[model samples]
Target: MNALRTLISLVFAALLIAVGAFPTGAAAQIGAKSEVHTEQVQARLLAWAPQGVATGAAASGAPGTVWVGLQITHQPGWHTYWKNSGDSGLPTELQWTLPPGVMAGDIAWPLPKKIPIANLANYGYEGTVLLPVPLIVTPEYKPGPLTEAMDIGLKASWLVCRQECIPQEGEFALRLPLRSSTALDGGAFEAALKSQPAELTGAQQVQVAGERLQVRISGLPEAVRGQALELFPETPNILLTAATRGDAPGPRSWTQRWDGAVWTADVPLSPDRADSPADLPLVLVTDDGQGWRADATVSGAWPAPAPVAAMSPALEAALAANAARGAAGGGPAVAPPAAPAAVPAGTFTWALLGALLGGMLLNLMPCVFPVLAIKVLGFARHGDDRRAHRISGLAYSAGVVLSFVALGALMLALRAAGEQLGWGFQLQSPLVVALLGTLFAVLGLNLAGVFEFGQFLPSGVATLQARHPVVDAGLSGVLAVAVASPCTAPFMGASLGLAVGLPAAQALALFAALGLGMALPYLAASWLPAVARALPKPGAWMDVFKKFMAFPMFGTAVWLLWVLGQQSGIDGAGALLALWVALALLLWALGLAGRTRWLIASVALAFGAFLAQAIGPAVLRGAEPAALQAQAAPAAGERWQPWSPERVQALLGQGQPVFVDFTAAWCVTCQYNKKTTLANGEVLAAMDAARVQTLRADWTRRDPVISAELQRLGRSGVPVYVLLAPGQAPKVFSEVLSAADVKDALAALKS
Candidate 1:
């Protein structure tokens, strides 16, 4: 993009240098560049009005006639949004600066496409397009002898984005003859252009209900699908996003929606052009998910009738039979359920604020409290040394912020790739659980005085701790917090949620915000003199307190192991337990073995791991997966299978109305939904009464199948609900839910 900007700059310089060539006239000494090139951009975008458009000047420059053309071309991968950029973005622009006596009409823009890019979606074109802008000549305007040369100039600007956005600018110029009218080629370029989306004759205040964007596409047949249907608004922010359901409308003739809508209609979706003008591109997405390319005029009802024989035999026969039947009996039956009025979509800001508040509350959580205490005590111990205290606090803060920033970036990257992840995703990994388990085991051993660091191999006290005891406390504080990484509050919850939807910078900012919130208490403790004075003195009893602190780490390790067992099956649990045992035995041997044999023993212990692995996973496979049946089932809804596209498809094949809930046990939002919405008696009754087969995709653990399915639906996180009504295509809901919404949907299906 920078290279293109440089080239654009150089071209402008050349154009300025060429200004001296213009002829001097009596009234006005006009100056203009004959021709110029736009920036040599790196394939991000290149849109232009083609000169190949048909020219139909009755007489060259006769009366108000003038030569005009369309020569537009766009780059690959790169695209520019239409008038309405949708959600958040601006459209392409071209400012005409023509010489005196020469004027150009509004440039005609062809249809545009709405392309999905990670969290945000954009509306633009992918390839070259021809936009025809007619040139108009005033009847009295006459070119003087010296100023016969005419110049056309344009200042173009567009927003380009791939992973990040770069604003591009350029100057396009065209030279023209001074004749009354001149002819220009308009065929080869004109044929390649796309047409605008079908629009209503004029602005219509349409009523939206549920997933239906009800506009009167009058004179159109009701039973349209695939490339035959779609909606585009002419109002700003009215249609923030596309709808989430339909093709199988409750009763209406047309309904459409995207995957982000929760529970069908209680939550209103923003129209497609949320942050910009509605007068923009609205490409039609066929029912089959194919693009609806333009074929003809943008002004009247689309698509001239095909030849008489173009109609399908089945459809034609049905129509004929319907006509005969209507003549013999009556009109076809009409069923229109009263659609609930449309509602407004709330901002991601609210969710952000919630996440922030949650981060603040998280400071009070038990898992975090003990760690904070240790951190505070360390500060108190170093209270007399204020500089060291500040450094420690700042180091801790840096570590926390760094951790959250990394996590936030990872979330965004995964989401962009279409993976549905959730909070505590690390906890879902058996390896992480095992590693944490091992860490805790080590911490416990340290507390048990099994061995000592910073001291002689078997000494009760560290060899260096006698000189640097404070160093140990600070290091311990860091590790304690590390061990508590999985325990995040609801505020961290929403920030992570928004992080997935924002640009990397904004996401990192939010992540850093949460980290600051988490570290604020520690900082306050350090600065508070009263808090510093309340700590116990450094003495023999310090050992006891340290040992007592080790117990929490041990317990935490045990909890991690259990979580691992559930995640990795029995074998993983066994392997982890075995690994801990091996470490303990080896350490004990080291403490007792003579120097001559110590090296040999250590080598054997280390090398033995490979031999154990060669013996197969069975040797270390824990006894956990087998034990799961004995444990009470997780509180998943009645009969909801784990999320699997194949399983959901099968359920649909069985003609059962399947409701697949995508959730993770570790996600706070998921837990809230379970406790309040899905677990509610009313929702349960409705589930049973409606005969809805429920399927749960437990994203609590990594499930490749669930992740792929989420990508298929254009989502990368949980709290996704898929409603596959009997004999209809599946529809997705959002991150939130309600019992009434489900009930209404169930009732609609029954009818």
Candidate 2:
């Protein structure tokens, strides 16, 4: 009886330990048999299957391949990335622990969707997706029954994203009976295989030039050709996926076309990576969720795309029409060009030369004259010190080069961000114009001996620092660039246009060349002692010249005021004049104030504040109305209608020739052309005879439509002459127009 009791207690203890070791739920699951593993992760439902691994001949017969699949169902709005995740995101990863004698192939990626998030575009999949993997089973593998199944494990990790992203991972196991016969049907696997990109039916060709890739695909369906398509490169770091867009040929973008049966695309490549043109792997996807895989070969050398002269007339017309439509909608109209062909080594050399010539000519423009005069005076002062003169020259050149580079970078950055800004974009703002006007007025007053700041300074220090070569030279460079904004010289158009589309380093080099050109004359004069000596000696004559220089500053101020008046109406101009008066009074009071300087300064500040408060709103409000009024009225008997992109398109569509004068009131070059060439009686008569529909795009005010149109024409500033003949690409003329040039263009139109 005692022995029986002891055995019972031992059995009870053993049972208790066993129950503690395995909880009821775990124990039940361990005993449960299943062929597949499924789990719900953070943002996705995942399932893994060793679907085709079967017992008998299927496993023990001659070595064969088995298909395994991981099916992931994303939560609504959540997605997993493709092999190439554009802009940002990570692709899914799978690691397997297969039985010995089994080898796994790469995941067979299905077609992915282009997922746009905010301003960025990503390639990914939404909803349910199955990733298929093929496994090779060796003949050495043993067959198994349902009770003794083969174990296959998978470690899967992926990123799922909505507005935010979540990383998820799971370890999954599958138990499958080894079989002698193949499994003919796999539900999810079959579907996944169907979704795989089909191989292209015909030959594909790829051409690489500089940072661009062009692909020619033959034998595509018409429906697929007409629809918007996206290209996915299997090779990483070769192309910019985010830069992809619908095909429109230009200078620095991706464009695609379907020429009836064959499809062609010019794609922008990543500048940071070098890729061979041979055997490019690509997948082309349509908007309707169909995709075709194509392997392209490098058949021959791909020449860089030629300029507009080589473009087809029909294509040019179509691009122009698109611009017109965008203008009509009051949106950005300039379509980015096709990925620019690699510029030849000689091309940059020519561009640099053009930039140099243009910069040298820029010194002659009316707007730059005042600053140039100031610089001449500075040179005269530094004439006695050779070292100082050289130093000043170098400093001036540095300033000019740095400023150009900075401005070019800003323009490029803005363009990249989709802002339709161009050269002299700063002048388009009335506030900038007003500020510059004020500065010019103050400088003019100082030069004219009105309340000199030097008078208040101690005599010794004032005399000692009267002329700072470095400061004067640097400031002169700044002033030169500021005034030069309103002028675009000959050769400047092509050079600047090319620079804007080139790679960043090349573009910057072009800007540097321009600056070097502008500063060359001054630099040469300073460095050559003979040239410096050729300048007149410093004397009372310089004082007279200095005072005379004030006149140009006043003139510039007057011009800026006029531009301001055009931007803002008469009332706004009056407000600016009032502000100027306040400034003058403040300066006068400061000069006269002896003991009560603080009190006078306070009063002046209050008066300025009062004026700004009273007039600021009116000035801001008047700008739009002024622009509208200008648009409504054509200059009296001007024989030119106000220009709109819509009007240009209509006239072109009707087979009538049109001449566009892109002008601004502040642009001295424009004013000169208007007075000299455009106003010539013979030119007017010729146009009249040709029945040319004259259109004036007045850019005196901030006009987005005109701005976009200028950019579309590859110009950044005013005084652009565009002569459009019926059914032909428009001819862009020089900034400084001549009667003969206008006549010749018109005669060509007639012919």
Candidate 3:
């Protein structure tokens, strides 16, 4: 989350704070629904791809007739969607009021495709599309050259998207010679339009005329649609709508049977139902198998009359004028509210304190517990290995402390650039996890007496190589802190929040303070030479202790397996098991022939191969969204997604704060704040009611979308409880929530 936040903040600053100064070349960055385009052509009210067409259209050069189309050009390994821009994205559309001597026509859609968006899937274009249209010039048309300097001037609107979406608009001008109907633009555009399947030339009704509910899909299958197809309705006023938008269940074939001779399309969705009225254009979008997309029309489909209620008071006031001009009509209306003032200083102070306390308490978390056991056990077993125990404990303690400073410093650097970071984030990265896994696995094998590390020359075990009293103890302190910190929690929230937001000097002081808190016990324990001296001399007990260390290490192995599972799934876990077996066998071989470095090297090679397979895909992602999201998300510490019940229980067990937000697509309020307030650093920090674990649930689609998640959260609608708990029952906020609202809830939870 921090990495993306850093980039986003940078981009946001360039766009909002310093216009046209973005270093990455996007001089024109706008809000989600807003776009600032400097391109050659302005888009239309809606740009129909193959599967779906926009709401309104102008008739072509023919009288009492019209046509619209979706043009597509696919790129290798990439494709643009037709009607159903599968998985996630808006389909093309166009809405217009016909000019005085013109009659409108329906779209001539091209084709469509199916795309996968990680956990979800969608159908759309991966390349480019040039949707065409035919407008009808009525007899009222004033013929020819002199009367018109330009052909037609129409307002265009549409949403263009890649991984993200941006709305576009422009004026489409087409001049026509009333007397001579020579092909315009050499008919190149027309020829391309003709290349499209005629079935999609624009028809709305598809019923057997006899069968009651028989299905009939008019569009033909193209390569872009792949071996299957999914239906998407353009508007309201149609029967059998749901049935049309779904993929055919069998092998590589689509069947739209006539349902007892009736034309039908699904009903339209609305924020307010009363506003729904007959007359809007109903476009049904469908996909071809591979790439191109085309949507003719599903008969009996039309958009509901505009919802006057969704308009603001000002816009609603225009309802009268709009009615005079035949604008959208309907009921109750509301205005978008204003945002509140900037956050207060006091809120920041508490957040910082929470981060601090959380960091201080992290030394005791179960995640770090195994590492500590080994640290403690190492010295106890080797406490007498040296002549005296004076420097042993201090050396180990030093290693732990130093490693922590390095981590703290790196996190601080990222936060300075406006990142939202959390503790134990390193473990979340596959590279780091795999490396740690390798480190621990080797250490475990060494402890099992396969070979021992001396830290320096002939060195293997970090504990064995410390040369001097101070350096050895200091290095040990550094190692302990490094190994232990990534797994601990509780006070981490406050600590991380403070480190990220405060001035560098203050942040370092706070971090050092937290480190001091962690090192305190060991510092004290190290000072007592008598305690170390009291331990039994090295013998079979030493072997037992060494073996004991392996168990914690074995635990580390298991933890790595879990992390691997998170990355590559069960297959990755399987490979890890194979690596383990190979390791075990090699270790056995080493016991029989300790001096055979080549044999051991081969085992190391096998482990390296295992790591390559586990982390290969993630490494190649570069700046892909999934990788970026992972970088940005603070590891839930031990929990995964917010929707998981197992994670909720784990957080509850720790008595930590759990912040969960139920959000959705249909809600404007949710979108507004998520884009503005919720993702902000201030909001993230204010969330320190207790050690906070943040979770987001995205609600986009209607049924399968909300259904699957709702079953998990045990909720029906969104804008629900954004539960925040410090150490108690979660404090819940209502649907129309805010940043301050969350802050206040967090404050209450802390109390």
**For residues 1-751, what per-residue lDDT tens digits would candidate 1 score against the true structure?**
0112122223322332233123234102111212222232322112232321112222244434343433334444555556656544456676777655546776555555656543334555656555456556554355555654456666666655433233455444455555433333434324433353344243322334443333332322233422244443333344434333345644223354432311012213342222322233234444443333222112222222223322234333444554555456543322221222222225445644655566566677766654665565565456477666666666666656666666667766765554456555566655445555666676566556764433223343334443544444344444444454677676565556556556666667677677667666676666666665677566676667767776766776777777765554444455556656655555455555468347754774664454234321322222231100111122344354443455555566677788877765333345456557788888888878888888766543334445556765666666677778755546766566777787888787778
Worst 10 residues of 2 by lDDT: 1-10
- Over 33-101, each residue of candidate 2 has an lDDT whose tens digit, in order, gives 212212322322223333445432354576666777677776676677888776556788988887776
What's the CA error at residue 139 for candidate 1, in Å?
A: 99
C-alpha lDDT score of every prediction, in listed order = 0.50, 0.67, 0.45
Per-residue lDDT, model 1, residue 140, is: 39
* TM-scores for the candidates: 0.38, 0.41, 0.43
Candidate 1 Cα misplacement greater than 4 A, ranges: 1-353, 364-370, 455-482, 592-751
> How do these models rank on lDDT, best leading?
2, 1, 3
Model 1 TM-score relative to the real fold: 0.38
* Model 2 TM-score, 2 decimals: 0.41
Compute the lDDT for candidate 2: 0.67
RMSD (Cα, Å) for all candidates, in order, is 27.8, 31.4, 19.8
Comparing 2 with 3 on TM-score, the higher-scoring candidate is 3
**Candidate achieving higher lDDT, 1 or 3:** 1
